[model samples]
Target: MKIAVFTWNLQVYNHKKAVLSKHVVEHIMRALFGHAATGMPFIGTLLEIKAPRRKDTRPYSEESIEKIVKALQDEFQSHEFKIIPRIKAIDCGGLPNTREWILVIYSGFSDVSIESLGFRKKIAHLIKAENLKAILKAGQRTYRPRQTYHTHGLADIMPNKNHFEKMDTFRIDLKKDPMKTAKEASRQSKLLHQGDAFDEDGDLPLLKQFRGETTGIYTSDGSDYSLNIEAIKKRGTKIANQDENWYRDGCLIKAKAVDSKGEYRISVVSIHLPGPNHTARDGNILNTFKVVGFRSNPDILIGDLNTHTEVIRELYRDLSTELSTGTTLKFNSAIDFGKTKYDRAILRTTSIWKHHSIAITAAEEISSRPGKIQPIRYERVSDHGMLTVVLHDGGS
Candidate 1:
């Protein structure tokens, strides 16, 4: 089976977002998945959906989600691509937090299955009830009781909370004076934690919390099966993933499917660590995967890791295996300021059916379908082209 995991940062700003989203879906479907006529492709997102803004600045509620999704479903159902969304948690942005960036898996290829892992009890509940695993978090950060696990979401149940062990990192500015930096860092941290202000430099804790947010996993809905999910709780700074560039979550999910065919275990990890300054953190994250058993097991790592060619070369410098990063860029990252390779991937110990490195030019075409009510011309959506890694295995 040829599978393509493409990453697109559709920074859509249309008020009629549903219409634009439909276009995005079709565009991506054609761009990454072998051909539009090919079987429905499975798409996973480490992306965000900006909500329709209002003066009140309220978080996205269930009603808003229902209407928006219904529209998308009505549009997608005809194409045989069902939107199986597991809403992990509503990311209430601070001040201008105008978007909800949950991880979502859009699969319509076949009888695909969905599962929720991590400390996302509310997300799990919704998954069970709606039969959709959400792109959500294990727990929400709160200051009321200052506890790890707490009640969140509209649901009554309290979500489970898991913490990342503080890791060792060489990226911290050892060049700076420690006494002065600590005093500054400590004061900034205290202010940010207290909500006294929203200075950018004082956001380390928030960044850490965001990077370690809860994420989910899924499989094709084939045959009756039972599932078991494991989360690698212990992490280190040296072999961990983080970035100061943007605020988002890191995902590492392990899933097993057992049915008549056989039993198969596959781990999927999505990363958003930026670089070249964060090289130590990025390397540590990869090494952490090795330490946590992802090295030996069949696994697929994807998302916007913000790596350049030299960095990629460095990452694979001493590798003893032929396992390759799935997508090769058609453009140079140095000139494009690394965005050319913003969304790169690495796959090892896994079976890949195909790999398509696609960079759609400034190409435009009119959609023939009346579904595109407007005389809509398709366009390249994001600045960074999609690097799709189609990786899977023959069942055990």
Candidate 2:
């Protein structure tokens, strides 16, 4: 069995404490518990940590980074975990954010290397997630100009009837970027479909219905709805958790992975909203939480929420009680307060999953363990520190 865990602190800052956090390090170990339950052979695993770009004296002393990594190696003491440290790498883009911070915690299975088996594919997807900043930036350029929101009366429900009839066949040009196509659609003033759901707020926000069609990028008027369906479609489809209070026009997404043998597994969308302070009036942060609450099915949600980890705990508790699925994402927040490195994920199955204690480890501490540590450092990773967790289950 194999699993990869990661966390990033986008804007938050501190020196030694930032490099590693007890909250995050332990989380990675617990998250892996699930894989271990599968009884798979133990292979060497890589613990990759990256710090965000900062100018002043480095956020953390190299010694601090090294100490944390060493502590982890000593703590596990088991051959099962091959604790690595200080894995640094170059970045094509400068840094993550202006605040200058972000960290990565990647723990691979003990037996597999990047070159062997299906590890490459898994690592590739993770790398893509790591590079979401680029993807979002690209989306902004392609979607902003053409974006619009509309509401429709019952009569307008059939606006696209004429267009649909004229075209009996639907063809999506893979070569042409779909985002570009959606942008063009956004720019059109002419009504393509009647009862435009996006223009204004209705009983059901338009973005919610169209979430599956798009991926999860959106830009809408604060009151009504706005979602980037094109991006959602390409990345994965997700729906929001079904909480009545947050039953607005939003969505949650799930990821589907297919193996070479034609086998597949599904995962829920993991998301983190910017600080509520940054976008409070629109209630974007609260809306995001409510959406997660309302979404149904199996999922794992994670991100730098800009809210306290305690809030995440409360939401999970409410969701568990309301949905009757005793499940939650646990975090350890001892070092820093306020926003935590919100790294989390979910499995969409209907069964309750098991968990273990969680921790947060430093990047440099990992480096001191020379033979096993290989920290991949990058600049401007993000503001919030990286977050990760390990899970344990017998595999249902």
Candidate 3:
């Protein structure tokens, strides 16, 4: 089984706001959560102190908090899910005299390959409830407590919190900082390029001319699962899979690879659409899937598509009617403490669904906010967990 983990928006800061350091902290937290099956490691975190120290910003009344905790415990016990570790934090965001907390409850299959992992569905449903309750209660606080979860940002929960209040929005000086500007510009430029390439003359390069001294391009390309962006660009005329006008969170990454049936393909698009932007993004997804080249031949379209709505069924129906083949992206990161809904990762082919084993696997949300009153030592991470799946070689 093949799996991929996706995390977004990991912002770590210090009390002075000037001491913002997210790189080391983010990596540490990811390493901890990424390798949790081994053992609980004391992840290192920098401590900050101030004239006014971190205070408990939990908004829930004691009575209400107990009720919520009881509810979560009752649901967890009733569902038979094993309890994972939960961490709380006192101060985050580098805000002086401010207190915050984030609690992450990790649980997953001891062995990922077991078919019984589907039972995690029950746990996912319960965990989401717990998260939702926390979101609601935290929203009621005097100050909107920062979230340490994957997707449940203060914007997602409160929706009305001042966006300026987000501490990570510091205007990074790019002009005076030539290295930073060059790096970001180069990164964006690479992302704008839409093919694969190799350093040597063999394969293809995604971005043609901007090849030398570009450091992060390789990492970015590999992150999108491209072997060599330069190599793919050399293979064929890189064409936009869909309209250039439509700008969504995902991109159109295409390559030519042999199909399962042994036919060389013209174009393959790897997309990563945001989970929340369904209506417009779904239309783009359907349109791209229905394009002429993708419809007729051996091409693979795969990525994190945040759409798991009726739109998916509609796409299935349309593809079925056209005699084309497609499957909804499968991977569930839903835990019991929050709303449990699986984001999608779809792979489409000319063949029907029955011919292949498309296993959509669920992983636990590794990013979380420490609970209020607990000292925050780790980084503030994204709330959405990762979803990885494998399409076996023989599956149609």
Candidate topping TM-score: 1
Query: How do the residues 1-396 of candidate 1 rate in per-residue lDDT, one tens digit apiece?
Result: 444555554444233445555655565555654353554335465344455544323444434545555665556565543433332322323233433443445443333333322222212222222211110111121221223212212112222222111101111322244344433333322211222222333322222231233322211111111112222232211211122112333455444434444444545555444343653433433333333323333355565555444223222221112223322222422112222344545555334222333342211232333334565533333444444555444531
- Model 2: lDDT to the true structure: 0.31
lDDT of 3 by residue, 1-396 (tens): 111222222122223222222332333334334433333212111111112221322343223334433443444343322223222122222121222111112222121111111112222222222222222222221222212111212212322333323211212333255345434443332232233212243222322223342211111212211123344344532222211212222223222223335532222223333234443433434444334214323223333334444223223321212211222212332332233232333344442321222222222334433546874443222233323222233333
In order, the Cα lDDT scores of the candidates are: 0.36, 0.31, 0.27
lDDT of 2 by residue, 328-394 (tens): 1223322232323333333333423333223333321122212225644433223333343433343
Sort order, lDDT high to low: 1, 2, 3
TM-score of model number 3:
0.27
Clashes of each: 23, 105, 60
For model 2, where is the 10-residue window of minimal lDDT? 111-120
TM-score of every model?
0.47, 0.31, 0.27
* Model 1 regions more than 4 Å off: 1-3, 12-16, 31-43, 52-68, 80-100, 108-191, 195-246, 253-260, 271-298, 310-339, 350-379, 394-396
Task: In angstroms, give how far residue 115 of model 1 lies from its true place.
Answer: 10
